[model samples]
Target: MSDEERFVYDGAHVVDPLGDLEEEGEKSAKHNRAKVGSARPSSLLYTYGPGAIMDLPQFTIMPTGLDEWDRIWRRRGPTPPRIHAPRLRDVVRMTLRSPDVQLCPYPWQPKKHSRSPEGNDLGVPSRVFPQWLRCTGCDMLGLLSQFDYRNTHPYRTDLAVFEHAKCTGRAGSGTRKATRRTAIPARYLLACPDGHLDEFPYDLWVHRGQPCAKAELPALKMADRLAGKGASAVIQCASCDMRRPMNEAQGEAGKAKLPQCRGRHPHLDAFEPKGCPNATRLMLVGASNLWFPATYSIIVMPDSPEEKASDLADRVRTALGDKLAKYRDNLDLVRDLLGMGHVDVTELPDHDLELLLQAASVSPDTPAEQEQKLRDWDPVDLLVPEWQHLVRPIVGNRAEEPKSGLTLATRELGPGLRPEITRVLAVERLRKVNALVGFTRIDDMDRVGDLPRRLAPLTRTSRPAWTVATEDRGEGIFLQLDENAVAAWEKRVLDTDVWHSHEEAHRRNFERRFSETAEQVNHKTRLKPPRYWLVHTFAHILIREFALTCGYSAASLSERLYAWPAEGREPSAGLLICTTASDSDGTLGGLVQLSEPSRLQPVVTNALRKAARCSSDPICAMRTPQDPEDFLHGAACHCCVMASETSCERANRFLDRRFLIDLPGSGLGFFRPHG
Candidate 1:
């Protein structure tokens, strides 16, 4: 039910409150003639949320909805506004991943509501944070805090560069004054690993945090040198006659030279009263490490009929009369809203209502029992139930077949492969809902749960109760491997000195990246087991082969590894390689077609053959676990087993083609000549 407004842009021009324009003079004559309106699925806002600076045709903008709360609460009169939780159904179907987290909808002023004639009619508003802007004509610098503007309108369309009257730079003729062009956002910002973001300390940067009494206000200018490197770029302040190079704000030495973090959250229009001790690092606006979304997902599975009580409860609710049916799903909430005296349960038959209430309660077990149930669940436990649902003998509801979100088919494998290969399941359809729980800046995604609390809130005064999410429909191929064969091969690999050395190399690589001490590395880093390595490597090799015939780019395809190597438990080995898109129709059936026996046999053989030798062969095959350049991968490179990071789950690490195929001096391949 959440929605937001976004400016639409055609191939030729962009139209908005900011002066309409084409691609920098390509179609200038038709710029002002283009139409503008809000577009559906407004994915731009979802892709680039708060803290991201977007380059619009006229001006650079940073979308921020933090101050909208003050405007909204005032319109609600003297009483406090209520922030209702999203319906329970929405939690299960859409925002289930981050059940505890929620975000408020961006304020908007819609013209009309189709469902309710007299209800509130306001479209979602677009909020922006005016940070630093640079004038195009004079190339002079300015800060948003220096501007004086009115806030009566829902949108700010009057942003311009007029305060700097001293700027004498001209456009064409010396006699006429130059009209300054739209301002561009500053390219650099300061951030900490703990997700704190602030405008770059331009004044302190140029002066090295030294006191300046000569001038209260300084004029800053950006100068580009012939080298064009960031280090060569310089910022000069005219008031005190001081200039500093951009090089003093980058890399390890730059990080050390910078000031401590001030704990600024520009998106929320707030700052921590007490400063943070974490060292702030200078990062470009477009740096990849700025935002890393933390997400979790589970494969759809069937369960025992006893566990299917929710479905029965849904049927019972439908059978009940309209008055009772309305509140049947959320009886607790309705009961709280209307006192026991108002809710007349005596009207319903006592015995039937009791049974209905029992069925409505999804779990009769205690909290301890529920926790144990989830803890004992494994890959096999989840997958077997799904497999059972797929291989049912008969199709009951003919009308429901087309509407069902999932379509799956399974078959036994043919000869010419190792005995470890068990069954293959081709998933023709799948619906995956990925909810954005929270994001981290300049840090590995390990401690995502401990993110800053103010980042994802349902309201200004309350904690988050829901999160934004998107659903992706897709197709995939699943392969189940023989657990016994996997365990035996894993045992052989574990016994080898090479494998032991690789484990050490992995530990070293993690320590170097996260700056973790030796003792911390063991507990913090989740080391990939040998079985996981083999399955992950095989998935990558197959994905590479599938990309050629599946008519999908390798980057569009992603792999999901299902492996459990817990001691005293039966191990499970499976891989699901799928292509997903934000669109509703999912994808073409090329992947499912490739999963057929005739097509699959050759694909598997060709993939194994390709992995047997790399273009960088003898050198690649001979590479040791402790190679200076790559400590995580072995006998793998772009030319062979390595796949795009988007396609691989483990960031393209822990992969060794040697684990999947025969390599020189490596006789421990799981699928090598078994005779």
Candidate 2:
């Protein structure tokens, strides 16, 4: 029996590190397949990811000059192959904007596919003001939300050269100076069932150099002189079934020109380019961005912090400059309230209210007392749910609702107009939340008050006292939350409102007793926010949930044990195989290492070997597919059990084989305790 069989027979609860534990096991919430890894399914989008959708708009432009062509052909060869650059504007206008590509947002019904009416499509949603932008500098095409897609494509040398030129910011010269000269042309004939142009357009170009064929010539044979001399060798066009005559084939230079048709026909000559050195073709996966009708530049929007603040100030000043002088006239009343003890608005003199109203109107353009006006202003002019709620109960209908649906509180106000009231409330709320959750009471259910400050004297700060919200049920946990601090939580996911509540909970837990000193608080928090960011970026958005769920267990995820050692010092090469007694059985048959080992191996090998057998398939399988021709396939093979224990020396030493033993000292111990 395999080690995996042993683990199961011994009652080990095996975990698949890469498996969707939340979906496959236990009572968890159901998730949409599309939103498994992204914030699209979450309510709090702001905290979901860093590239939050802020209001400010930004743009980027792709490369558009022809000079990029010459350099590309120099390295990759002149062939009618696929090019993976940004889609041109004309392409986007003709392809993506077509009605055939669009599907209306409706339920249960199959999406209607129709061609786009020329120049008649509605533009992007007006409400969206994107602050993030990605540009394809090579094709002079700017990637837009409505346009670009991702897919693997064959590699082409010439196109690669052009793309490199744009990346390096090197513009080419001549008639080809600013135009796209690098993209060679090739025709792809369709094997149509009804010969209908309306149903299908010709396949778009993919720049990979290799052509579609039943069998490719050996790489070594292609470079050898004797191989070329073989008269029986032939080159056939995939689209038209044209075979090149031996005399016409000449050499690599002759093969470079994409064959139009087989025979020496006038139509074939017109389609084929004579002496064209860059016309090789291939079939592969590809996608296009929004191709515009005409060339356009995407200008970078002003998002600098200073500039944004300045703009807001300028607008405010422009709006309220004329009223500044009247507000400052009652400076004495303002100063009295500022210094007075816990002075509520009702306690202030009538003159103070007048001054406060005037201050609210102060504009950013005011040259003199503008600063003073802002300082004396109350932030309540901005929306404050707490103050509004409080004022309703305190004032008891002193102010009447207006017929125009406008009031002191409900009136439209810009960000600059409501500093005092909004700022104070937000800051205080942030402080409250932070202090409430901070190191006050570890188990606040029964015990309450200054969370028995357990920090050593050197690390101690001012410890605040706490009270219980519920003592009888063991439910209350005191944690202060203020506007400024709480804003961080909202800001984290404000862009999309697709926030991760679990991460928010973790953040609150960490904030209770976090410090800047790495050594002091590093190990305490395992929020993995940065890791969340990376997973979404490199892989699909759904990878985040996978990582999060797996991370719950130190054994399965093993963030600590999964070490990415420095270059040239990677782990030893040990083949891990997963086998079974028969196709029907998922149980392990046997295990072995491909080679012998030294003493300095990892202690987790035995555990890994045992765990490997516990599942029908290994947990460490790569999510991506490998090249079928590459020799490294074995390195990532899904099958390949260890040969035998004698040859598996390295694996035995690296992995603690004791984990293979049938002992009862498990995490959930089965051994009896001493009496």
Candidate 3:
């Protein structure tokens, strides 16, 4: 016996811990009102009789915080009862309001190795737990803590022994005494709503050998006739003589090792039973508050293309029953459709109209679409202003920029020409000015022009009768001598200090002097020896210096030059020819023969026959007036500068000759030429 039970004295009835317990029992049937001082609402206050005076306070509407009593009442309404809140661990819940987060069906995995001798498909398929049944994170331990199970008990029953049993009721009269007892005095068993066998304890009377039926079973038992026949038999239990079904008797027997009922009273925690797949043995166990409904849905408004979308929506809703039709008058879906150009909103449909109305009653997507449709209604008059600003410049188009009174060509001819110039500039920046300079070299290798021609080389026979040679700083300079040169003239470099830096300034001075000299000589020579020879000579100097510095033999340099280009034209010049010459082995630097091979003759005779169109000035000659040459010579191309500086075969010699690696002031510095 428990310590609490031992406290009961032999003569005393049940003790009353609550002082009003007797009063409560006496007043249980009365619904009478309490005195006016009572805190609870009373029956008197709710009575509708004419003479029943309501002494309660008058109802008054007041601003929320403006009234002190209203504020206090509002604050008190949300406070929980004095009891503490339930903990997540201690909660034994049967129904959940929110949808449970789904976990991946296959969580744990097994390794791919053999374990048993009979290694035949020893792999186990993944076990899937019912979505509503199991706890997510932990192994089942966490789920057990949520329930309060203090009121449940277990019982022992012999199923085979009760297969053939019977019970007979016994009654007693005080004046008359029975000679023999029909059965033991019937004792009542406390019943559990959840079908648990262990909640109540009683005794049974047995006749033949068969299970007996209960005299006072609950409504479900009487109405449903539950319990299948001839499966497992339910006999009146000797301890708790309640008539249980065969399955119930067997389940109790299986758990017979649990604590047995010993005159202790137990109340079930709840009445509902759980049906979880994870449970090992199926038995009746009660769950608290376990009713739930099954399915749900949602609806949204369709997008609108025309203006009367709201009216149309209202009409549709009115035609259908308000409870059955969802009126989607909000504008959010329509706005989204407008932005996307078109949309099909019929794809998502909802059977429940009320749910659809709740979802899209105030949509933001449709309102914006309606606003835009109104704003862009007219499309014909959009571009009138732009055309007005552009008419004047189109009529006076010219080739070059004008200056001073000549109108200075407004920087660029017009807007249309600027784009082409920009495109050309962009190409130059990407490929470098060497793009123009390397034209002849590429042409020679790829056969770029219509006619193929060759230039004469200056051999022993081609040497003039009289040649003037001047030695300056270990470098030999050669010039053709003629009688017209009467003035003792000297070429001098001026403006040596006008550069960004001292070295750059000096380098510029050197190039300027060389280029100026070459230009002057070009003007003097002109058509006499041919323009091809001028380019060839300049190209030869660059190639020579480049090859010599890079450690190439003179013969190899000559061969490379000869293969590159023989004759080509540039934008400013015509049918240019070139030939190459070099000493065998490494003894002498290579040279390109620029003139025809003919025996030396008188200076005057040589000058006349080779006489280009010369003027009064001996330094001046008839330069081939411009030609419509579609291609450019390699020597004059700025692209060649970038190519030679970067990947040209003659880069070293060209750099040695002090040639600029890139075009200067050409606005194409970003480009690097590729070979």
C-alpha TM-scores of all predictions:
0.72, 0.16, 0.13
Over the stretch 316-402, how does candidate 2's per-residue lDDT look in tens digits? 222334533543465455444333422234554667455454544543233234334433332222112222232233233222322
Name the candidate, 1 or 2, with the larger TM-score value: 1
TM-score computed on alpha carbons, candidate 1: 0.72
Give each prediction's root-mean-square deviation over alpha carbons. 9.3, 29.5, 45.1
Better model by lDDT, 2 or 3? 2
lDDT of each: 0.58, 0.21, 0.20
- Cα lDDT tens digits for candidate 1, 72-106: 33444322222222222223223222223333333
lDDT of 3 by residue, 233-304 (tens): 233333224444434433546334223322211111111122111112222212111111111100001122
Q: Give the TM-score of candidate 2.
A: 0.16
Candidate 2's C-alpha runs over 4 A off are 1-675
Better of 1 and 3 by TM-score: 1
The clash count for each model shown is: 11, 89, 34
Q: Global lDDT for candidate 1?
A: 0.58
